[model samples]
Target: MRDAHYEWRCKAITPIWTGDAYQKNGRMIPSGLLGSVRWWFEVLVRGMGGPACDPTDPDSRCPDKHGNRCVVCELFGCTGWARRLQFKIVDSNGQPVQAAIVKDQEFVFHFTPLRPILDEEWALLDLTLRLIADYGAIGGRTVFKPSDERRRENMPQHKDYGLIEITSWPDIKVEERQLRSYLKQSHWRNMDHGDYAWASLDNFWCANGKHLARQNKDDSNFNRVLGRDERKTCKICGDIHDPPNKCPKNNRYPHRHSENLINKNRTNQWIAGDKQESKKVFSFRHPQRTFGFVNPEVIDFSEMKKRLRKAWPDLKDDEFHQGSDLLNDLIRSPGGAP
Candidate 1:
């Protein structure tokens, strides 16, 4: 495979990431652009049938360290493999970007290729780009998923869509030219160019559900529910849904005092919020464009309000709640009011 390079310009569609952990210079990007790229690469690999590993599962995310490395790790590099690529990021002014850490801020990145990639790796990298354009950020929050209830109603969840522009040497084959053309009018210049991006490199979007997790049984986000009491049965319906976190009733924060709304009125004995506290392990889901446990404290109060409205479309913008407050509303009341 011959060596070649490509360039990309992007804007943060959502607050890339939030929280003190990601605090830096004046912005936040998703665990650094490379980290986000790695995530997309993994997703592309799995989505293309490269491997069945879950992006959130470390054991599966990376290949066996000793001798068997997965296709993703081989190119993206992991403890088991050396990275097949290298990058150099900069602003439009041609100055290198700095990830100084800023809490709860939106960030973007403008990538100017610094090294030529082997021709074979181009396809995978192209696949990665498709994912970014189609999936936005990979781990904490995703771009194209509709809410469970919304989907059941036959609503197709459209991708929240991120802003991205790519320019490459014509001789080099690139993926999705139409997307790039729409992004920047197929602008091509013989000379080099540059731009700026602000993504919360240290934000928790990388860890919200899977990154924050320590285990996975090797399946979609649907089956990764956390288990606390394997033998416990739902008191209201006397049903046993394998993992205890499957209760549709328990909602929000620290996982304790998380109520089971199912038994709310029927038994007046709703899983005693705190009774199952010590014995319950909470299952976390992939947060769609909406933010969940990705460091809410560091997220801008105003932005939090905005994203909250989307998460709970039933609520008006003026009445949108933030943090756990919004979550509490998600658990329907005994009367069926959201």
Candidate 2:
């Protein structure tokens, strides 16, 4: 069987962290980068109004009652199915990368098809990589929050990780209709209500030239936007304490509204040590950019913009790009525009 293979040369703009199971950084893990690619691919699928199952959730994963899979599952695979693409990272000399942290290095992403890959699938993958190179980030630790621990330390301004430039790519042309038709296939449809949020293009929002501010004494614009824990004070004694826990002086708790972007409910999930997973808003410090999808059920576009502007006064109206608008602008094919 003839296998479809493609390669792209990439340069890491910042440090790339593809850590091991122990969360130790300093080595290249192909699976780590593949996972990030899959994530962005899933986001793109959902943004384009295609079905993509949450692979992490057993109930929402692929191989449904009819043995059908979502568009993402068909290519990336899930339980009971193997991925169609084999991914690898090699240095400029075509040697396997030995470094843990991929910083300022030129590497190549080698993708070999394990099965007969379709043109639409290749187009989708190409689009995803291009998006990451242009406006988004890749790999892990892209959303590093310096305010958490290094706020008081005299450290240099934190640079964004996972930023890469695609220096070269194989010549492959696919029409927009091909992708649309492929997504419309019956086998790629799955109807499952999962807890994981689907990042649709209609709900996506992004901006450049604005980033989280570094720590300035106790003031950090970025931290303020992300939100800080405000301990509730005892109503009687005026002592601070976490909710549901009694204060030193009094048993009664104070009733106050939270001003955090990530509320109490989401903050509690961070106890599992995956703070990035719990956050909805993602920012890059060096590029001065932020991008995230909003749950329209929770907040509308105007309201979300208002809240962000409240924290970032320098942000202008012209700087923001709605997901739908970006799709139309970035995609070249006629049918690519939504």
Candidate 3:
């Protein structure tokens, strides 16, 4: 019987073979598509025999969050490998800009130690590596910009710093322009912008309307804007948008509202409205809330760190710090993390 530790370790590290059957010691272990069907058959056979698996208990021996034990997802959820991609960008003083950078300049660059192949094995191997950094936005947007307070204090501005597209890997197939636009539009949900994440996802789904924008070059902006008529009001903020456009301050795409744009007073009011309100609106519109899955399984940091230490048995604390700083610099662009 496999113990919890054994099962966990196997699930964590092994890339379950998505291939055909292989005979090992004259015992045929089905794999790939056939294996999937066979596993289902065996489960049915087991359930019929007497000892039944509980369908309600998620933490039970079920392989999936749905308690259906999806072997494929159990082996590989939406989880991705964390890799340390180093960028050696030097300032005029020859000092490295050591900080985590994200989506730098809208391009993607593929990096591997000694040029590692981007095969199934490398991907699974990379997942076991510890992530030195993660990226997100400030004021509830993915795009980062220094706040007024930070700017007043003369703090560094944070922005995306990864390449827009990784040209080397054709398999990755990133659309630089599309991603940049998606990210930029996604920023509108930020407090500094207008907190438009809720609807922004529709505009930027699958990296921004891939079907329409990418293929048809559709220029029709899909964001909801208050026309001359629309019955709606902000419940939490108590700001109303009753025609003559009551809540122009909270409008997602206020610039599109030409009537509201005409008045300097309205502009100043929105410009000066509680910054917290802006944050609320941003949070309300955040793409992550709409798109993020519930109870997502995270890469176990404890195991990952343990693996890292084991792999580099002689690595110093400063080396780890330096690696972290380098990774950060690679992700955070000049504007800084938002």
The model with the greatest TM-score is 2
Pick by lDDT: which candidate is best? 2
lDDT of each: 0.35, 0.69, 0.23
The root-mean-square deviation over C-alpha atoms between each candidate and the true structure, in angstroms, is: 18.4, 6.0, 24.0
- For residues 1-338, what per-residue lDDT tens digits would candidate 1 score against the true structure? 54544555443433333213444224434345576677555444433334323335554444544355555555556664466665555555645655532222233343323344444355456545543532244323333322233232123232222323333212334333332232232221111111100011111121122211212222112112121221224544444343334555543212321123323431122111245221111122333222222222333445433433333345454343232332122122111112
Pairwise TM-score winner, candidates 1 and 3:
1
Clashes of each: 24, 3, 38
Tell me the tens digit of each residue's lDDT in model 2 across 1-338: 23669888898877887888898776788898898888888878887778888778777878887888898888898878899988889877878887765557889998999898877787788888877777788886775553323542224234467888888886666666767777878756557434555366667788877765534334555545545433223445555454466655545455422223345444323211243455566677655677766675565667657757866777688888887777666577322222
Worst 10 residues of 2 by lDDT: 266-275
Q: Order candidates by TM-score, high to low.
A: 2, 1, 3
Taking all chains together, the TM-score of candidate 3 against the true structure is 0.20
